[model samples]
Target: MRERKAAAVRERVREFALELPGAYEDFPWNECVIKVNRKIFVFLFLGHLVAGQGDSPPTVTVKLAHPEAHAHALSAPGAVPTGYGLGRAGWVTVPLGEPGAPDAGLLCDWVEESYRTVAPKRLVARLDAERTAPPGA
Candidate 1:
């Protein structure tokens, strides 16, 4: 059933997001959230979220560094701007369990971008350094 499939997809996406530096999961408000430095960067909404947007259980919301990135995220199928004025600040909703949705690789990239956008400068700098560091370092 789709429910089982949704769970699998959510788990995969959750694992990918959590692997990022400083990323962690919590259930404040009983809602699944992924954060960095106690600041929310990703929210995983399950069931009836954004009703009519898609037939997906888990919809992933991320905050981008700039509103310009909004258009790019929304260009993907089943992706939309987060409502309640969040969209005005560069937030986007990515439907995780929807058919034709972005694969885990692309979704992980988005998660990383969102993490960098909201993460503290020190954490971001560390991530940057890791990228530039040699293979063994």
Candidate 2:
């Protein structure tokens, strides 16, 4: 049952990642790197959330410019302090427990916020223009 649940989580996360606008590269150590117009906007890492593991399934950790979003995520259920030096920074980690608990939309919101937070103002403007422009126009 645990294996099945983990597989489901992996599939869901992968699909959600692919749905993000712009191309991405799946990096080593279970990291997802998204590039918009050849610029990196988001990088996601999946690490062991539970102890006693050999390559555990990914729990989402997003990078933020400031600490507000990180604080908010920490307040949410299933979200916890990221260990191994990341928590010391402003990274908040969210676990993949009951899928119903933290739905994909909410996770995607965090990803979107992280992208906006890290991306430069000029790059963000370009991305925003691309987003608002008519498809293929």
Candidate 3:
């Protein structure tokens, strides 16, 4: 049941990540990742998608370049710095389907932040422009 819930949340987050400009899915190192312009912005772990793959929990790892956002994300239960020295660079892993876990909205915001951090400046600017553009204009 927990895995099912986590998978649902993971799919929601994945869909949100893919909506960003230049964002696309990739499988490197046999792991799922969402990248923009050749740089990985989000790493998604298995969440009931492949049963018996392992005993690990479902989680999403993203780089929080902003200091306050980084701290806020770490405050969530089961949230932690991403390993393999990525933690030193402000990457955080947020566990899903757990108590005190952040909601899909917050996770999607972080994914956008991560996208802004790694995507080219032009792409980032384009995203910003699109956000501020008037409706039907």
Candidate 4:
């Protein structure tokens, strides 16, 4: 049912985040968290694991740089400002299972942006180089 579908979505998003350079997952508080350079960039939560958060499962809480991007992301369905004073810093909770949740592409984009915001400058440079470098060189 919905739980199965949501689990699939979690796996796909996990794969996408781990594909980024230096990204890895950790089980802090038993919740799946993706990190880059030892800094948490993405958090995946389901069920009451995110208790009191009021957000649905298959949710990704990410950090954003610009207010415009934060505002734009909040405009999407099932998207909400992250709680615990995090929203002031452009963090948002985006539900992947909602009827109008952002597509895979946009979510990945948000993940990338969050990574860029938190990762060390050297690591970010490495990521950019990989993207700009010609194939096989």
Candidate 5:
């Protein structure tokens, strides 16, 4: 049951990332790497952390922005401090709970923020141009 739910959530996330402007699939883990003009924006490690856990599914780490949100995630079950250099930048590692631990909306927002943060200024400007461009101009 938990596996099914986690898969569903992961699929939703994958779909969201697939729609990003310049996102693409990455090898070795089939990880989703969102980019803007070839520059990496956000990385999805859905199956990258499953070596030791065995039956338990791998964890998901989303780069967080607000200090409050980071704090909240750290207190949840299955949640842990993000490893590597992301910890210094306020990324929180939240485990996709059994069937229904992570909130979809919150995850979506985090994903979006992560993508935006790593995107280059020039690409962002291009996105803005597209968004603000007239319907047919």
Candidate 6:
């Protein structure tokens, strides 16, 4: 039951990550990651995929360029700096299936921040333009 919920949350977050401009999935090291312009912006870990992991919650790791957002994400339950020295570079791992985890909307926002941090300048500009453009224009 927990694994199912975690899978659902993982899929939702993965879909949201792919919606960003130039975003796509890649499996380097056999782990799912969302990338923009060939640079990874989100690393998704789904609990059910590995045997014996047993209800390990889904987590997303992102590199946050904004200090406020970084601090905010790290405040979540089970949230922490990403490992392998990525933490020093502002990467944060946020568990999605845990109690008191941030909602899907907030997770999406963090994914966008990561995208903006890693995506090329022109792509980021395009994303900004789309967001600020008039509804009908």
TM-score per prediction, in order, is: 0.82, 0.63, 0.90, 0.88, 0.71, 0.87
**What is the lDDT of every predicted structure here?**
0.79, 0.61, 0.88, 0.82, 0.64, 0.85
Q: Which residue pairs in candidate 2 collide?
A: none
lDDT for each residue of candidate 3 in 60-92, tens digit (9 for 90 to 100): 999999999999999998788887899999999
Cα shift from native, residue 119, model 5 (Å): 0.6
Residue-pair clashes per prediction, in order, are 0, 0, 0, 0, 0, 0
Question: 24-136 in candidate 5: lDDT tens per residue?
Answer: 65543576655555644445566546446656554556666778777776776777667766778866666664534676666766766666666667755666787699999
TM-score for predicted model 3 compared with the true structure: 0.90
Which residue segments of model 2 deviate by more than 4 Å? 1-23, 30-57, 66-68, 134-136
Assess candidate 6 and give its lDDT. 0.85
lDDT of 4 by residue, 1-137 (tens): 76676677777778899998899999988889999988899888775655565655678888988777788789887687888788888889877666676767777788899999999998899999999999999
Which ten contiguous residues of candidate 6 have the minimum total lDDT?
47-56
Candidate 6 RMSD computed on C-alpha atoms after optimal superposition onto the true structure = 2.6
Cα error, residue 59 of model 1, in Å, equals 0.8
- What TM-score does structure 6 among the candidates reach? 0.87
Off by more than 4 A, model 5:
28-43, 46-54, 125-137
Q: If ranked by TM-score, best first, what sequence of candidates would result?
A: 3, 4, 6, 1, 5, 2
Cα lDDT tens digits, model 6, 1-137, are 75666677778889998987888999987889999888999999764443354766778888998999999999999888887899999999887767788887788899899998899999999889989999999
